[model samples]
Target: MTDTTDPRHAHREEGFPAQQQDQPGLTDETRPDPDHGESTYRGHGRLQGRRALITGGDSGIGRAVAIAYAREGADVAIVHLPEEQKDADDTLALVRAEGRTALSLAGDVRDEDFATRVVTETRSALGGLDILVLNAAYQHDIDGFESLSTERMRRVFDTNLIGMLFTARAAFPHLEPGASMIVTASVQAYQPSPGLIDYAMTKAAQVAFVKALAEEAGPRGVRVNAVAPGPIWTPLIPATGWDAERLATFGEDTPLGRAGQPSELAGAYVYLASDDASYTSGAVLPVTGGKHL
Candidate 1:
């Protein structure tokens, strides 16, 4: 007999309950807390003995990936804003539960110094680095392009793009052959939204960064790739300043008729980081819910 489950109704298919949180949202505050695959993921030594540094790993997709990486046998270090220490602690504890070394570095990725330093810190703590998940990001909705403040635009670019560059540049020398760098790009790169104009712009730039860097990193036996996720239920969603109605129907427009869960994206990261993808580089694997990238 074969097991069958409907994809549309698999995890969460109904609209989300209206909720909101401040920037750099907390996992505890998100209603109907997002799943990080704690109970479902079963690893088979896919990433054994690897050391990874994941930015924005305090919560959301970053946290999910951290948990998955740890379970897959990777010592993990996560970077987050000092304000997110509580969330970071929870994620670290989860990593530790897997009996793997876990490090949490609290600092704003927007700071060039901090961004670069965290890479060194992770390497020192983990002994070496083999996987770099450049997943830190920030986004906010705009009422209109005219109303988008220069401050907000700068913050978006700094956190999402500059931070990525700082950490990647710092990791290059430490990355040996077979090292993998995975950027958390987004479906927004392909489909832009007016309210998230600045955020979308940064995401699009990330895709370009992945492609260009892959050309440079590939010849060194290092793989550079990206996972472009569609509408997923993460703290970033509620905190993006969406109206209640918009929040309720957040991902209903997807062909899947539902938003994705962070857990659903783990396999893509794992596959890209593992030798299974030895021949894969300069690729943008879309985890979008039936959305084309």
Candidate 2:
């Protein structure tokens, strides 16, 4: 690859220390700092008066979306695991800094009851649910088929797929006409990474679910869509069981020869969640820095 990256933000090495965190990572401790639009995002009221709930909004792409949505004038609620309180607090602060209503709700999507409670509380607190960003995911890599334990596989499916199903079902009742449901699928869905079979399967299933939901929800004036991103610099990358070498050169194989920043993806999310995309549904918007779907 020629590395034809822009200079000011050229494809230089992302300055993150080669290290890993627990299953769901934290943003504050990351080196080189994954940009979550903290300093530079400029919004123009695309989502004015909207109310939204985002899962995994404690950090990374979810945090970026929350920040962008708040800047665009939406009341936002974010869901995170109890252990991720610090990241959730940071996300809440960032949203509040935009002078918008912000709430941080902590719960595990793996529990159906918890998902329902989160949705109900979000609607009550935020007034109503105009947008749903289902982005929380679990990915623990295995060497191959043999190393994959059955217990691990089931856990992945529960957290990554069944949880989404539960949350979406709970949120559907609160979603009114002209609402939007944007999911976070991934390039791994179409690309199918061998080591990440469980994660990839859930991602591919999400794309299909979105297309089906778009059809089912269209008559109700609700739009369903997804974003499939290539390698992006985020806390999750470090926690995904990659070795130090792979972690050091993450996203280098992409045509852009660099990993994407979480902030870089905020625009696609904002557009999909905004009225500007009222006619856009059942689409997978790929922000892969030149990678094809």
Candidate 3:
């Protein structure tokens, strides 16, 4: 009998070392670099000849999806902040390793012009766009909801919602029948966390975005969906300004008793982006390690 890896121990199950980084953390700065499925994923042309654009694709969950998409035969274009140049290069290299076209676009998604430009750039560079992954986001723990300043709140809202809207709006006109748009939502949307209340608001809004857009795009043959993840270990986690103790025990409360790695999310994204999920749309597929959505 083929030995199937136990889900409970599929990836790192231990607590993380206490650490932190400035916002938009780089992969190298992360204590244990996230797994982007470099050596493990094997694709069978699920996305052959497809073109995709992933925001925040320099590292973390975005990078994982980029790797999986490339292996599945999709040419990829990744949008990221200029500070993530190093990580972007690394992701580009991995995609090119699969002989897929890789384009690195550096810009802040918070800028509406840039967000719109990325879709244009991806379409131009990749010849056409078939997939758009709205995965860019920002989150900082709030000590007290009363102290949530307008500036910080705006940053979270702009990055998580406005930026996503800008990109999606720009891509809609270009999207043809059969194209797909996937949002990277969070479990916090359903089960709100006091510390991440603002972030949760945006994620919940994303669910509405997916559902409402699905209705509008369905007739056009385009699909809109979301993937709500649990406590996945990514650069975003270290950069969330959590206390060392909190960082160490992150995601341990989950049913799996461990944090998820970026690699683990690759399959969910690949399925949603591929023809395998042809009939799936307006759905929020949860990758939360058994966490109830």
Candidate 4:
């Protein structure tokens, strides 16, 4: 467990520490702080009596949102890939510590059947559903587009775009009026990345889907929105192809001169899922360190 009270772990003006070359080993503490402001973010129970399902809630921004949602009085169901069980467990513990019921489900979002099963289980376990967060994503770094194989591109699209659609569709039936759907897009959606062509394309598609879905569901009172984040230090940084040097310089080029923390993105999700954003839908909130997009 991380010491959330540590100033070094808090959302410092200097941001989270960059990866250290001298330290080859990385622990939870060394990883960027995912849960920030837990001791201080006072929730007025905006999501009181509501239930939420968050994909990829195992870590990164998803974990942050889970904690915040719990604080805001909403029970949470977290879905993660099988390999992310440890991170998922950590998030579940945080939710439970917040005095909210938490459900941890492990499955690949690429499978539509699995997505449907997760929704069914979450609704059954949580008793109802009022918010759905599409946050699971997959990426692989290829130095060039020509080097990207068709199979890899398919996998990226399946997990990043298709999976999100399936999850939303599965949850749609159970979502009532006033329910909200939030998708995790990426800054790559607006700013194309040559090396990450497939991943960026899928993210762009996600934004379009959010807009269209919001329009279609508007009459039904379900709002759909997206959060496009910039560089954020997470396990994905190491899991993906980013080298140590790149990780060390993460977000230094952004106007903020630092990458964002998962905690910084949590409030956006809470606001979108809560009644505070009642009139807001089909909107894209960019937490990209002031990237011009």
Candidate 5:
């Protein structure tokens, strides 16, 4: 007898069904009301007067955070890859629509020199930086370790980890008391998957980096934190080659039974970058639907 199951389909059987969860009304399309006075949220002025620079701010969780920060009264500088200029422009539009200043910069985070330039330009354009969000990442899956090429593995580490370090180093001097640094980690950091070994390893490094850097920067009143998001519905999914069925079933295996949306995790970033989390440092906040909890 011959087997007919697709290699991709084989993985689907290991996961559960997707569940539907009701989400809050805010979205990319909703216009922010300036005079609403934080009535829309339980917290007010969490990041007031703060100036933030967010890498990968063109889309996904980055875009969501940019909008949320503006609503909370912060100016934003969004850094994006060259190929994502349109998304960057859209994000800037949303920030301006929120009645806050927005700067859109295009470059790759993998280059240390470019990372430094981004920091300089952002400060000149935004006046200064109080919060830094290192949210950019890249990954490509391989079936087995033997099949993974050195080039692919290097690219994964360069984007997910090395670039993050460069961004942080470049922004360190500009960050002062009450400022915060937030990095986007993933659930795979704690719960590894064979197919995404390289990506998972880099995420694990990010968790470690956050803790170590927090201690080093604590004396200066700068806080460092990370957000470990589980499967979320982002463009990276379809762009990375997931089929309709696989994409539809994304995040189903977790206890929540559904993938989270980008908007769902934005508040956590806002809180970490705000004064409300003053005593919170060297911590990793898992937005993973109770996974590994």
Candidate 6:
């Protein structure tokens, strides 16, 4: 799988199927299924006694991280929308199956005030927060600037950028030097798609925030970083409103020849959260199937 040239092609023969759904797409409906490492991920107790809070943990990269964290011996609290309860339940079951504590909190990240509340509730539920994963985001494709609406732009900025700021700030009081904050950035931040201008802006802003926050939070031993993914197949894709053709051939242009699976991404977060990454701060790790950052 590390060959970086479609080593996962056996799984890619099916490709990431072309599909569409309303915002916050459901995982059960996604074709070929997304691999969250359920039967494959083996734990090594890397995160024993750690407590974490991950946004959008009901599915996609967030869900994969949640499963990996729990298997690594960390208790987890996942924040998701009320409408995503079904998916949340599935994730919760997997965590508890690992003998790790799990909490599913429902709320909208764009609520502004909800960010602090989400952190507060997670800390209280898990006893403390050493790992904060700001993995939730909002994105949509547009034909061009003309199709981009002020409302859509505002929603994107509010959810993708403002929410990260609010959640990270709220978790500071609960974090110590060994704590890690991992934001879910995108390669799109560095290589912008004309159709994704607004979404890309927020992602680039996230990279800047990570660098600055790492410096400021260093004295306290709290590291800030981000994972920039390329075309990983997740519910977010179809939910982003991509057309049929774009959806069908997604990630084929990458050197890998196909999109990445969610399972392929869990290790980066695990490393960042574990003591293994003690000195790794303010770095943006790209997991784009060999795509350049």
Question: Which segments of candidate 6 are over 4 A away from where they belong?
Answer: 1-10
TM-score of each: 0.98, 0.95, 0.99, 0.89, 0.85, 0.96
Q: How many steric overlaps are in each model, in order?
A: 0, 0, 0, 0, 0, 1
For model 3, what is the error of residue 181's alpha carbon versus the real structure, in angstroms, after optimal superposition?
A: 0.3
- Cα error, candidate 5, residue 176 (Å): 0.6
Winner on lDDT (5 vs 6): 6
Which residue pairs show collisions in model 6?
177-221
1-293, model 5: which lDDT tens digit per residue?
79684322322223322322211112232212111112333336677788999998877788888888988889999988876777788788878977889998888888999877888988898889999999998766576789988997898899889888998998998898998999999998999888789989999999999999999999999999999998866555544434446656677777767666677688899989988899999999998866972
Q: Let me know the TM-score candidate 3 reaches against the reference structure.
A: 0.99
The 10-residue segment of model 1 with minimum total lDDT is 1-10
Give the best candidate by lDDT.
Answer: 3
Write one digit per residue (lDDT tens) for candidate 6, span 150-172: 99899899889988788888888
Quote the positional error of residue 150 for candidate 5 in Å: 2.0
State the lDDT of candidate 1 residue by residue for 130-212, as single tens digits.
99999998899899889999998999999999989999999998899999999999999999999999999999999999999
Question: What is every candidate's alpha-carbon RMSD to the true fold?
Answer: 0.8, 2.8, 0.8, 4.9, 9.9, 2.0
**Candidate 3 lDDT by residue in tens digits, 224-266:** 9999999998998989999989988988989988889999999
lDDT of each: 0.92, 0.88, 0.94, 0.82, 0.78, 0.90
Give the lDDT of residue 286 in candidate 4: 91
What RMSD does model 2 have? 2.8
For residue 195, model 1's alpha carbon misses the true position, in angstroms, by 0.7
Off by over 4 Å in 4: 1-40
Clashes by residue pair, model 4: none
265 Cα displacement, candidate 2 (Å): 0.8
Ranking by lDDT: 3, 1, 6, 2, 4, 5
Residue pairs in collision within model 1: none
